[model samples]
Target: MADVARIAGVSSQTVSRVSNGFPGVNEETRQRVLSAMKELRYRPNSAARALKRGEFRTIGVITFTLSTTGNVRTLEAIATSAAQEGYAVTLLPVAVPTQDEVRGAFSRLGELAIDAAIVIMEVHLLDEARLSLPPHVKVVVADSDAGDRYTVVDTDQAGGTHDAVNHLLGLGHATVWHLAGPEESYAAQRRTGAWRAALEEAGQVPPPLVRGDWSAESGYHAGLLLAERPDCTAIFAANDQMALGLLRALNERGRKVPEDVSVVGFDDIAESSSFQPPLTTVHQDFAEVGRRCVEGVLHHVRENGLEHGTALVPTKLVVRASTAPPPRKVIPCS
Candidate 1:
């Protein structure tokens, strides 16, 4: 600092202001200090600055898996939002959703320099691993049902499902069939419940539930069975990938979409619009969810206290070519 100040013909205070990017330093002086810094190859000590400020300017993110579209997109949004806030993101992927694995992740985060953490996983394990989190680190949860225990930012899963079912029903389908994701997923569970409720609310009986592992192959198998059912008019898959497979099965089984069977899917993934027939689906704002998670984390950090509640990012129902009223039940003249 002193050498740079002397070379730049500026006071140490001026150099400090320039290095820290504080205002009031004219362009010429700032350029001179920068040039001196370049000549000396001087870089500010981030660790020392962090210690002095009592903040690492980093947020740690703990997630179970990145294979799912939602997780990957949400993670990307978090990194982008954090960068905009002048904070860096460090990710830790848990190999499993077990309590022990979650605890291990938190323990590892505790040893790092992150100022806070945002957890992206089911809250059941998080409830058990709550004790393992570092005392000084604030936390915000994403895509989980921990609102009563911790701050949570998530998509309106139930609301989105209701929109999907209602959209199908409003189009004149008697009832909507659901192909759900794994039972263990909070999101899948919420959507399933909402589907059933939406049907019952509309005075329609809910049909048997179909289960999938969030895979297109599972959707294909489910579609084969559904294709055989003469009464199955409208179907809702849990995600876009599954919907793609469902479309293929329906086509191969001689069921034309919107002509024989209409289909709706959740998660308006990028490829959904290009499906054999563009899919009508629910659009979850993963970017908004991620942005809220970071905002909640920083709020806790600034106040030095945890705020427990759920913040839901709204979902939209995107109508496309895949949905239409059920095929007319033609009857022969008696």
Candidate 2:
């Protein structure tokens, strides 16, 4: 602080005011102080700053896989928002929330000195595990099914699936076959329910559903069965990866997309548009999901108490070349 002030020809108090973001510093003084800071390459100690302000200068975000597109996007959004708010983020990765892992994570978080935490566990059955966090630290659970006891932020998986299937039905398809993710996933369950409901409401029998573990391989296997079925015209895949696999399976079997079978996929992954024929899929705004989660956590942090609320982000259907009207009738075997 003394060195920077000497370099900038300013008082130490002026340097302090500039660094602490006090508004009274003149523009010229602020610029000079910043220039001095850059020349000195002096990095402020966050821990020391926190100690003086009674803050950690950081928040924790805990999630399973950082590699998944959805998870990555959500984390990025959270980090971006936190940075904008002048806070650093500490990322904690846990594979699956077991009782021990949940307990351990919270314990480690306390040692790290974070102001609050956000958990990105998206399964409905993890309600029992959500209670393990320390109550002193504000906690926000994303995609939670823990009732109103915990704050939650989640994309409208069911609503997106409903819109996708409804679009297919409106295109005059007989029925939309579903390729779902692992049965245990909350998103998969919601999507499956919505698909079934849409079919039921439309007076069409819902086609048999094939399960995938959110993997392209599983989707490829499911696609093989779909290709052989003459009644399979429109297919709704749980996510874009599976949809890509389905596309490959259909291509290999000499079935033309939209011409022979229409496909609708979820997540609207980045590569969806680059497929041989662009994919039509559902888009979940993951950044919005992250923002909501941060808001929930911040709310609790300020109040020092859990806020019981469930926020569902909206989803939209992106139409492309992957869907069209079904054939007039199944082509007879030669």
Candidate 3:
């Protein structure tokens, strides 16, 4: 800051204001300060800035995996929002959240002087440890039922699944088969429930559940299994990656999409459109969810208190070539 101030011929306070994005600073001055900052390669000290601002202006993100399309999208949104808000983000990955890992993360978070934390929702194993974080540490859980104690920002996973299955059934398909994600995922369970309910509501017999780990490979394997069944027609995979695999498996067996088997996937990932046949999938507003979570936490932090409620972001189904009517005859197994 001092170097920037010297180079820009401005006071340290002016540099601080510019760095913190305080609004009263003139455009010219802000630009000059920024230029000086660039020329000198000056960086703001987040810890010192936190001390001055009386809030760390830092948020910790806890997520089990960034490997999935949905998780990555959500995290990207969160980071973008945090940056816009002049907050730094620290991403922490815990493939499996053990008590020790959770404890260690919280301890490290405490030492970082972060103002709040936002944890991506995991269906299981994280709640007990998450609950143990200091009450004063503001937290917002994303896409999980953390109850009334923790603010949650989530998409309508169940609702979206219901809509998808309902769409498939409305197309005159007898019953929709499900390829669910890993058992522990909240999304997988919620989607499974919605799929089953849609079937039950129509008085149709639901097919047995097939399990996958939210991977293209897993979806392919599950697809192979479904392809062997003569009755298989309309199928809904838990996510797009799996759906892609299913598409491959069906193709390999000489089954035509929509014409032979209709499919719907979750998380309309970026490449869904470019797939061999554009994928029909659910679209989640991750940016909206991330912004809401940040605002919710900031609201609590500003009030010197907290209130916990869940934010359920809406989802839409994008129908594409991947889904269509059943074939006239049951396709023989290749």
Candidate 4:
């Protein structure tokens, strides 16, 4: 600070105003200070500035697994949005989704220099670990149903699932089968429930649910079972990854997509449109979810009070080559 001020021919207070982006320093003066800073390669002490402002200007992100497409995309968006807001993001991945692991992650993040936290609650562990979070740290949850207890920002899981199922049903399919993700996942549960409700609302009996571990391999196994059922003309997989495996399985079994069997999937991933036949799936606004999460937490931090509610980002149904009217049954000559 002293060196930069001396070089810029200004008092330390003037340099501080320039470094902190405080208005009052003339444009030429600010330019001189910046030039001096650049020459000396001087960077302001963020830690000291944070102390004075009573804020770290950093947000901590805690997530269960980055393996899933949604989590990975949401995390990327959060990082980008935080940077736009002049805040840095610190990521802490919890190996296990247990209460103990979640609590530990919160404790570790509390010890760090973060003004708030955004938790990607793929599972229900947050419900059990809520009380363990630091009182001073504002928190916003994503992809969970505990909105009544904590502020949450998430994709409209049920709405997307409803749209996916209804699209299939609207195609004149008798009934749409579901290939669900892991049972414990909040997203999977919401999607599965929505699928069932959508079918029932159409006066169609819901078919048996096939469970998958959110892996393509699991989807392949589930597909094998559904392929043998001639009545299963249309299917909705919980995610695009599973839908990819289902497509391969159906192809191997000689079931032509949108000809013999139509498929709809959630999470319109990047490769979805490039699938062999292209995928008809629900599109989640991961970037918007991430942006809202950061915005929600920062709002609480600025207000100095934690607010609890749910903010849902809308989803879109992308129709592609994978979905169409079910095959017309051929009748033999009497």
Which segments of candidate 4 are over 4 A away from where they belong?
A: 126-132, 330-334
Local distance difference test scores for all models: 0.89, 0.85, 0.85, 0.89
- Candidate 1 residue-wise lDDT, 20-100, digit = tens: 999999999999999999999999888988998989999999998888889999999999999999999999999867778
Off by over 4 Å in 3: 1-46, 126-131, 329-334
Clashes of 4: 0
The TM-score obtained by model 3 is: 0.87
Return the candidate ranking by lDDT, descending. Answer: 4, 1, 3, 2
- Per-residue lDDT of 148-264 in model 2, one digit per residue for the tens? 777778898888998999999999988899999877667888899999999999998887888887878888988998999887899999999899889999999988999999999
Q: Show pairs that collide, candidate 2.
A: none
Off by over 4 Å in 2: 2-13, 28-42, 124-132, 303-306, 331-334
lDDT of 3 by residue, 90-116 (tens): 888876766667667777888877888
The collision pairs in model 3 are none
Assess candidate 1 and give its lDDT. Answer: 0.89
Clash counts per candidate, in order, are 0, 0, 0, 0
Per-residue alpha-carbon lDDT of model 4 for 147-183, expressed as tens digits? 8888888899999988988888888988899999998
